[model samples]
Target: MKTPLLQFTDNGIYCKKANVYLDPWKPVDHAIISHGHADHSRYGHKKYITHHRNVPIIQHRLGEINVTGKEWGETFDVNNVKFSLHPAGHILGSSQIRVEYKGEGKTSILFGYSLGKAQRLLKYLNTDIGEIYTHGAIENMTEVLRPLVDFPKTTLITRETKKEQLLGNIVLAPPSAHGSTWIRKMVPYVTASASGWMTFRGARRRRAIDKGFVLSDHCDWGGLLESIEATGADKIICTHGYTDIFSKYLREQGYDARTEATQYGEEETEAALASKSTASV
Candidate 1:
């Protein structure tokens, strides 16, 4: 059998042709990261490549490091393989890394975290969509990112603000504020959550959300199937999240599908822990 262009390895998704890894957890010579999320983008690489907008974010998180920033859709070559970064729409600097070798292309989260998801919501949303209001936490985080991203105007919720002012506005807040007295001012509001989990049946109800938008940084099941079909890839590898079940279903559909173990899914936990630490401070 021919060696696949991309292979699952101890380090991460590796491309032997390019001698590089994608979002490797273990240290490697060169790593092409998809985003700045902790799980996807880690420290200890000799060289790093990611979307240009992400440079500040990773630099802030990882400290001084050798890194290169690439523009969306700008193709570069390493060895015989071609690579490019495409907007992932997950966060301000998030990207979907595309690797092409022998004319094949492959493509690969949540609003809960303030830094990434909150900014994404702010960027895409507009006054035409709805008046954007944000909790102080979200507002503060967004202000930090204002220099990096062009965000829509957002109003910070304040004690002086009247409930009537929020009547028809979209309020962006963390999950912790959902049932708190801080949210009482928005009592007449309809609760909505934007998350991949919203795709699950009854997820909205369980969260007491009056409306659920299947807006997520990650692909839903339907999106996964659509993306797979679009790729026309003979071999499919599932790295994380319902991997076994998803791979099995893919096999049942006659695709060469399999699962690979990876160190992912810890980003949310880390983000939650960080949030708690910040709250305590």
Candidate 2:
């Protein structure tokens, strides 16, 4: 079955396949959100679907929108297209999206952000530009030009050299086995990865950061490729990344892949876009 050609936009559609909105940032009549992140979940909606635990968060954000909570593995149909939510791992209630078209019976493309370490599992580094000189580096002009950075290489090395230095063991929680996994034993899945804003507070907790596993909120190059391979997908639509490099890499691997440059945010829809052009003229 031909997977409905997915058009990358704030709101998504598959004419023959049930429409699936990855994460509705704009005001939509009906919506399904992957998580409660401010960028993903926004105001205005008649009904919204999300994780059961996120109902409160949704309510707080969207006010009176009818919030529907979905458990992992449950399927719902929207205009004949079947979509199911799976754990995304970016946050407590994040999900990776899977959609199927009833007409084709072929599994539609799987939209995954690829999982990352939990919010609490990592501490980010924070260095202020102003502090570089204020902390006595002002004495030497040459020293001011030099950059200073702190990475947790020592802690990682220590953990590898001495097991006692390891505060906690790293455990890889395999993706859901039966439904999402192809083999049911071990198949890789992309978790929603995000880059966090570093703060001075996080810099103070460098020890904690060192002890935790470092991962991204969006899929890295390797993880993106792995997700594509795991799905056994014939064609891939890459977005939200350095698409040129990723698409080139995918093509090198003999996969029919293309990169999609989506908009900055929902603020730029077709109608809104047309209006901007008119206003500019």
Candidate 3:
């Protein structure tokens, strides 16, 4: 049997090959964090390796620490193990870490309390998803936060943007904009939302969205299945929501699956962004 590459302990999952822990709950010499979320990117690590764009937010939240940020595709060497950070699709620099050592490999993705949820919401949007337009509130807040974080490329739905332009686009706006007068102006377009909540057709129906994508920062059932298949990892670790059930399901499917304890979970959204209103129909 292949020796376990990463083992879960009280401190968190330890990568024996790298001599470092991933999102370690307690302080350690070297901690390779996946993102800036508080639960996943905790304080007290002697050194941290995360994505370059995440530096400011992590620094702002964690204060003084030996943190080294790297570009998404860059590889960093540690104890003969190769580590690479990739976008988690959460925030400016929220990342998923991929590690390779001695012919073995694994990765970890993090998502928790932090800003840029709005931006993460945008990455999943496209022509296939839909073209992009946003609420004045989300756009305005993005403008204010853009200097601080790298939000997804977006356009504000203003008077200048002809109504014809909105025909084939997805509007990344606040919940309040749903069925509001402003949306009436942009006819011939359907509405949708991206979240784990939409995993069920009933939820999607209740949401009344013409379409709903399971585009959660957190993985959905299908996402979990798809990720496991895509990674082809022999062993699987469940750390987030519905851990026990998912872990059991993985085990039934013939995977080395187990649940671990971690306080990290879903986070709050920007209620303040909903405060502003757009032009009326």
Q: Highest TM-score: which candidate?
A: 1
TM-score of each model, paired residue for residue: 0.45, 0.35, 0.38
The Cα error of candidate 3 at residue 169, in Å, is 2.8
lDDT of 3 by residue, 65-174 (tens): 89888886687788888788866788778877777675321111111112355567654443232355667766776677778765567767676777766553456666
Q: For model 2, what is the C-alpha lDDT against the true structure?
A: 0.46
User: How should the candidates be ordered by TM-score, best one leading?
Assistant: 1, 3, 2
- For all candidates, the clash counts are 1, 10, 1
lDDT of 1 by residue, 234-265 (tens): 99999977789999999999999999987776
Residue 88 of model 2: what lDDT? 75
Better of 1 and 2 by TM-score: 1
What overall lDDT, based on C-alpha atoms, would model 3 receive against the true structure?
0.70
RMSD of each: 20.9, 23.6, 19.7
Where does candidate 2 stray beyond 4 Å? 1-5, 10-16, 103-281
The local distance difference test score of each candidate is: 0.77, 0.46, 0.70
Clashing pairs in 2: 18-81, 114-190, 114-191, 114-192, 115-190, 115-191, 115-192, 193-217, 193-218, 194-217
